[model samples]
Target chain A: MSFINYSAKEINCKIVYYGPGLCGKTTNLQFIYKKTRPEAKGKMVTLATETERTLFFDFLPIALGDIKGFKVRFHLYTVPGQIFYDASRKLILKGVDGIIFVADSQVDRMDANMESFDNMKLNLDEQGYNLDNIPYVIQYNKRDLPNVVPVAELNKVLNVNGVPEFEAAAFDGTGVFETLKSVVKLVLIELKKGA
Target chain B: MPQSPFVMYDEEFKELTLIIEKLLREANSKCVYLVDKDGQLMSAVGETKDIDATSLASLTAGNIAATGGLAKVIGEKEFSILFHEGERDNIHISVVGQRVILVVIFDKRSSLGLVRLRVKKASEDLTKSIEKLLSRMQAGAAQENILKEITDDDIERLFH
Candidate 1:
């Protein structure tokens, strides 16, 4: 759920980046954190295991300028992509305003991507949110990898809803902002409709 | 989707800050803050310069949600309280009114027992305050559109 504090003149929304293990979900967040100006971003917190794998989630709060007179802040989070972390994944999606499914485009990781996508749908359903209605975008990440699957094939499996999709090499920051902007725009549109 | 949008007015914010401040003093805690279950910082009090309130709020909410999931797997209704003991500081989180969380961070000056005691009483008051706030918002929601202040043009400019 979005928190709109009239007294504070702030609009806070949560967005989650989800995909399979090693799908560069956290890299997308790191890219955003690095590119964001210090004045516009808060401390980036990563709750991860000793191995650097996300144990719980990675959270970054960013100020996306202003809308009207209110400061629009977006809290970006990435769920632990490992299959064993399903419980943690569900928790992070508790009040998500928008989602970015960072699908691994590598030919070998296709199954992992599909499994994670299904899990996302199931978790959203359990939380009483239908993926069809929520504002979301897809990022076929790892595009620079030589073994990557074709965009057409990835889209056939993951983009059934035909939501906005982008090809990204998150580590290099390619398509990162494009994917972020697309999802944020969709979220703002949703907020306008709700208003 | 399960809950309505969390909206806090000036009066309610004042009341909440006061309560948190009192709790901080009474518990001898370094800081006390209120965070929505959705991870938004509502109100905070005490020394927080060394603390990153925004990040803490989000992580605390994640911690609570994870614990709640654990509670479900164990066949429990909910785990209302969570405590994390560190080498120096400790954090005590409790669910208030089922929507917001009251977190108290303390150092060696206080004990968990004392923090919990203060939190128990503070949670009750906070719960009532939040309930009142929500009811007032609901009552006036029909008459006033909080989003009315935001226009289509304003939103359009955001993307550009």
Candidate 2:
């Protein structure tokens, strides 16, 4: 849920980056954190294991300038993508305003991608949100890798709803801002409709 | 929309800040924070110059959410209160009105008993204000429609 603080003239929205294990979910966040100007971003928090895998989540708060006098801030979060962390994933999706499903495009990870996608829908339903209605987008990550599934096939499997999808490497920052911008736009449009 | 955005006006903000500031003083706490369940920091007071309020608010909500999940597994409705004691400071986290998280960070100067007592009284007042704020937001949401004034051009400009 977005938090509109009239007193502070600010609007805060939560956006979650979700996908299967090692699909570059945390990498996307790290790239964004590295590139965002110091003034525009807050400290990035990572709760990970000893091997640097995300155990809980990663959070980054960034100010996307102002819109019509209200300073718009988007809090970006990445869920622990490993399947065993389903409970943590559900917790992260509680009040999500928008979502970016970062799917690994490698041929071997297709099953993981499909499983995570289904899990997302189920968890979202449990939280009283339908995936179709929410402001959601998808990122086909690891495009730079060899043995990657074709973009057309990935779309055929995952983009049945055709909710704006991007092909990203995430490691070198390809398509990161584009995906972020697209989802934020959708979220703002949705927010306007409700208002 | 699944749920309306959490909105707070100036009046409610000041009222809440007053209650939190008072709690900070009475409880002898180093700091107090009012965070939305969605992890937005609504208001904070006391010594927070060096603290990362945003991260703290997010983690506090995560902690509460995880605990609430645990409560569910045990057939409980929710775990409303959470306390974390560090070597130097202790944090007292509680749910207020089931909508927001109330957090108090204190050190050796304050006792848990005193913080709990003050928090109980303050929670009552805070809950009342929160209820009023929610209703007001609901009533004004349609009429305000502030974002409706924003155009595609406005959104496009943000990317540049």
Candidate 3:
């Protein structure tokens, strides 16, 4: 739910980053945190396991430029990508206005990506959000890695719905903002329809 | 303009916050706080300083809102208790009368069941106060006599 603060005249929306473990879910957020203008982004906190895998979640409040007269603030969150953290992931998906599905582009990690996508769908269904219609985007990350799945093959399996697909090297900051922009824009459009 | 912000509640409702405080203490829990559906902190108790109550309040409400949405999807109304287990401890977040969020954080020392019971009572209490507050807010009485309530120094301090 977006809050329309009459006092501040700003609209705040929550956007979540979700995907399989090590699919660069946290990296996508980290990249944004690093690249955003210091004035535009709030503090970013990432709590991970001993191996540095995301444990609970990473939260970053990013203020995108004002669209029309309303200040657009997106609270970005990333759930732990590990499979055992399914419960935690479901909890994090709560009240999400938009989503970016980061699919690991590794050829060997195809199964994890598929399982995570399934988990995402199941969780969304339980939360009354339908990916088929909700504001969503997709990114095939690790494009720079060798033995990475070709875009077409990845799309054949992952892009069944054909949401905006991006080839991202999230660590180097490739296609990160494009993915973010597309999702935010789609969410704004959805909000506009309601208005 | 009530005696106590919580005094408007009858005796049963009046004991709500105390009950939550006592329960947390007994369970050796870290902290407990009540937040509105929009994540505004209504009241807090225990060691919540290190914890970002603002974010916690917002996220807890978000958790509640999502559970409510899930309820609608499956032909249910809304979940009363949502117990999420962390690696060491756990977070017990629930909706109270569909108006407020009651959150309790505890480690292995505290049980989820106890937290749930106390929150149930607190929810009843909070709902009444919240409803009354909302009606009062809508009446626009809160906006009246604004200039008389504060001194010039207070206004000046706001600028500095």
Candidate 4:
């Protein structure tokens, strides 16, 4: 349940990034942190382990301009991607307004990507958010890798409903903002429909 | 309907606000306020006038929500405090019984320990009030009717 503060005139929405470990969920946020003008963003908080695994989540509050005079802010969060952290991932899905599924494009990580996608659907379903309906987007990160899966095959297996997908090299800022923009744009459209 | 929708007669909410004010005063702080977990500004006291109390209330609630989310991920119960230390000024925030967040923004003349003690009492009071609010809400559509009872003028007040 989102808190609508009529007194503040700011509608804050929570959007979670769900994907497999090392699939660049955290890197996507780090890239956005570096790319966004400082004025447009707040402090980026991340809880990670020594080996760079996300321990809890990364939070970045981005101000996406005003709509009809209300300052619209989106709280972007990334769930810990490791399979062992499934419980943590489930907790982060509570009250989620939007989701971005980051798929690792490496051909060898195919099974892992599929597992994470299935996990995303299960977790979201448990949260009462339909994967097919909620404002959802997909990002195939690490496109720069030599062993990356072909976009066509990635689309065939992962893009079940033809959700907008992007080939991204998160470390290089590739397709990062495109993914964020599309999901956010969809969020606004949902807001317009009052859903 | 009870006397006032925005006003609380339950001694708990009132006393909670007073405790908050006392804490801020003792800290030589600027102001203080309590926001429910859902971001409702329960009671505010201080130079909240002319300032962005509404946004502060909502953001503080957001902070609590974020922290609560983190605690759950870590297998903890919940977070009750979030402190943002700054140069010359700082924001001392604490969550009360997971129901309301107590905030105190102070400058040079105070200690964090003192703020914590006062907030504990206020938190207890605020928690009781929220318990009542939740129970009242669970009582049924009466709460929705209460909102329905709001006049056009009140709705206008919300926008303006």
Top candidate on lDDT is 2
- Best model number under DockQ: 2
Candidate 3 CAPRI category: incorrect
Across all candidates, what is each one's fraction of true contacts kept?
0.68, 0.76, 0.00, 0.00
Which pairs of residues clash in candidate 3, taking residues 3 or more apart in a chain or in different chains? A21-A81
Cα TM-score of candidate 2: 0.98
Model 1, range A76-179, lDDT digits (tens) per residue? Answer: 99999999999889889998999999999999999999999999999999899999889999999988989989999999999999999999999999999999
**Candidate 1 lDDT by residue in tens digits, B32-85:** 999999999998888888888998899888888888888999999899999899
- Measured over all alpha carbons after superposition, the RMSD of each candidate to the real structure, in angstroms, is 1.8, 1.0, 10.4, 8.0
Reference-based lDDT, residue B33, model 4 = 81
Residue B118 of model 2, lDDT score? 99
TM-score (chain A only) of candidate 4:
0.96
Candidate of highest TM-score: 2
Candidate 1 CAPRI assessment class: medium
Deviation in Å, model 1, residue B114 alpha carbon: 2.9
| TM-score of predicted chain B, candidate 4 | 0.72
lDDT of 2 by residue, B14-113 (tens): 9999999999999999999999998999999999998999999999999999999999999999999999999999999999999999999999999999
Per-residue lDDT tens digits for candidate 2, residues A40-69, read: 999999999999999999999999999989
Question: In model 1, how large is the Cα lDDT of residue A130?
Answer: 93
**Candidate 1 vs candidate 3, lDDT winner:** 1
Model 2 alpha-carbon drift over 4 Å, by segment: B141-143
Per-prediction DockQ: 0.64, 0.79, 0.05, 0.09
Per-model clash counts, in order, read: 0, 0, 1, 0
Better of 2 and 3 by TM-score: 2
